[model samples]
Target: MRPGLFASPRPDNLGLHDGLLAPAPSTPNGVSSQATDSKHFVAPLPMPTDCCVSAMEKLHGIIESLGHAEIISADDGYLHAEFHTPLLGFVDDVEIVCNEQEGVCHVRSVSRMGHSDLGKNRQRVEDIRKRLEGWGYCC
Candidate 1:
């Protein structure tokens, strides 16, 4: 079978919209730091300093070290990555946007398929938050 064969269609709202990473899908398979609802809201990672560029670079390294993450695109303030599950080969798209003035990294993570992810999306964000915090960044 092809990779992501069971994956849902690429979301219309996938990338940054109006200078913000797209909101999490209404389904429980997604979560976003910028979301307004408790179900979709995850806290943005707080930067250790005023340098968002350097912070993003650090985040890049962290994601790479997480194993299944493949960074599809990245710039000083924005990044996109794909994370694959080990057994079933599910794919999740993760995006991060750095706000320099606010010194935070806004993030969104969504499964490409499924209405429920068994809390995987939320766990991943929490994991990322913990890892970033260990690096002296806050979330």
Candidate 2:
């Protein structure tokens, strides 16, 4: 087994800062809907007109439904989850920042290590986006 297979350092650049999730790093190993640049830009999730709690529950449900996902922290409008790569156990941190007033949810996903992740972070967010849409949410 690879050393540190079960260990992942806590991400230093996570959480809601001023009602927004942190931007994705310049590296390809990260992606964020809030990112201004095209390289890291993803469309934010669109929330239904329901209450914030209901929207959060839907978001939480989608994340939890992902087989490899483990929610680390959550609250009324924020959530952090870790997704593990099946083979090597690489960890990716995903955070969602819900802006109830705007009816959108910002997202960020980043690998804990490596200079590049072959677009996995971007793909992961896209996958979640699709799943949310399938469940009657929009983006």
Candidate lDDT scores, in order, read: 0.82, 0.81
Q: How do all models score by TM-score?
A: 0.88, 0.88
After superposing candidate 1, which stretches have Cα over 4 Å from the reference?
A: 1-12
Q: Write the per-residue lDDT of candidate 2 for residues 1-139, one digit (tens) a residue.
A: 2324754777777887776787787777898888899988888887854556666678889888987788888897788998887777888899987776777888899888888989998888888889877887632
Cα lDDT tens digits for candidate 1, 28-138: 999999999999998988885577877787789888988877898898689888888766678899999988777788999999887998888888878887887788653
Alpha-carbon RMSD, each predicted model: 2.6, 2.9
Local distance difference test, candidate 2: 0.81
How far off is residue 30 in model 1, in Å? 0.7
